[model samples]
Target: MRGVVVAAALLLAAAGAAQAGPDLGNWRVDAASDGQVTASLYATNKLITGNGALGYSPVLTLACRPDGEPRWSEWLQLNDAVSASRKITMSVMVDGTSKFDESWSVGPRGKLLVREGDDGIKRLVSANRLLLSWRFGLLSGRGEADFDLAGLSEAVGQIAASCNTDPP
Candidate 1:
């Protein structure tokens, strides 16, 4: 019994240390549809999962070039039960300054790339911050979210390193 307890304590300590190493709380590398590698910020824990039905945790996807320069970014709300074809507008702000504003059409599946193209994703990541807002239902419904761009630079570096791409 004593030996078992000691071994269990050691294992628990090891697990805690491992979780501390990378420290990417909700960010994960997603399989790429195109050549670029992708990392997404999503909640997988039970607390977030429990509230999944309420559409609380939207997925924020960031794609990077092979050389670690940001390629594009996307956001999509998940688990929304309403099946209405709708139009929405998304805006991005950094340091209280609006950087991107675009309209998107969401299908019945509730999946939409809220913003894309040569938007300011690279610049935002370079500056290490993001602020997002969206409006739907003919501007009747709106929401906003903020994020602190901590450790993203290192995360992007890891993506490049994993793919064996030279960092840009």
Candidate 2:
């Protein structure tokens, strides 16, 4: 019994240490093998429905690859699966200002892939907040998420450095 208690204490400590890894504001950076790093931040506000139903907070993820084309891939992971994998126009607002309605692709597992370009990334790094509104037809319904972009620059810098690529 004493040995078991000691082991349990050690496990708890280890778990705590793991959770204490590097974080910049609401963003969490994770390093994977082969010079890959990912930074993720959850939306500060939940998606509320017209009928007063609340949905889970969406996650914005930035993944850096050392030897992949484009080097970086940005994803908005929705709580529910998208109806289909197709092009959709998403309304974007940065810092409460209307940005643009960009065409985004719904990748596998309902992940919306941000268009590959410097414009989108530039806005993200320089803004304090991001709001995305999309209509996923009747099946998936409409979705809106507001993300807090604090410390996003630092998180991107860390991942860029790890992958030896320029921050996008």
Candidate 3:
């Protein structure tokens, strides 16, 4: 069941990127019959520019299930191409308003992404909109990704319901 949900999330993300322009156009939610939900945020070069080869595209995947808390993961196509310093700073803007500003160390292989945990996930799911910006020093540039929270509220509610709990 978990594998199916994960595959669905990946499929939704890939299809969305092909359909959605480079902007915040690739937000989607997948709810599985087994009470699992996955939300994906995919950004293309059109939305995240200036990273040279390192920022071709990045995808954020959040998976939630009735038996456990949400889990987050990020994949960058050019992770190996990024030569930036290990430390990177990222900021989240909610509806044009600043919300989270923090820094994390990119792993040696450049695979690490800042984890916002349950509180941050709740905040994002509740926001009307949001933007994520990150500085990639190796590229001597930064990239921005946006998200539209149009259907997120209901999606989150449904995900919470799967656990027999209220939306966090």
After TM-score superposition, the amount by which residue 131's alpha carbon in candidate 2 deviates from its true location, in angstroms, is 0.4
When superposed on Cα atoms, how far off is each prediction in RMSD?
A: 5.9, 5.0, 10.7
Tell me which residue pairs clash in candidate 1.
none
lDDT of 2 by residue, 1-168 (tens): 999999999999999998785557889889887777889999887865435566678888888888868777777887566565777788899999856798888887665656554457776897898998888666657788888888889888988888888888
lDDT rank order: 2, 3, 1
Residues forming the 10-long window of minimal summed lDDT in candidate 3: 72-81
Candidate 3 deviation (Cα RMSD): 10.7
Q: Scored by Cα lDDT, where does model 1 land?
A: 0.56
Best by TM-score: 2
Which candidate comes out best when scored by lDDT? 2
Q: What's the C-alpha lDDT at position 25 in model 2?
A: 87
Between candidates 1 and 2, the one scoring higher on TM-score is 2
- In order of TM-score, best first, we have 2, 1, 3
Measure candidate 1: CA RMSD.
5.9
Pick out the ten consecutive residues of candidate 1 with the lowest summed lDDT: 43-52
Per-residue lDDT tens digits of candidate 1, residues 113-132?
44454354556556545666
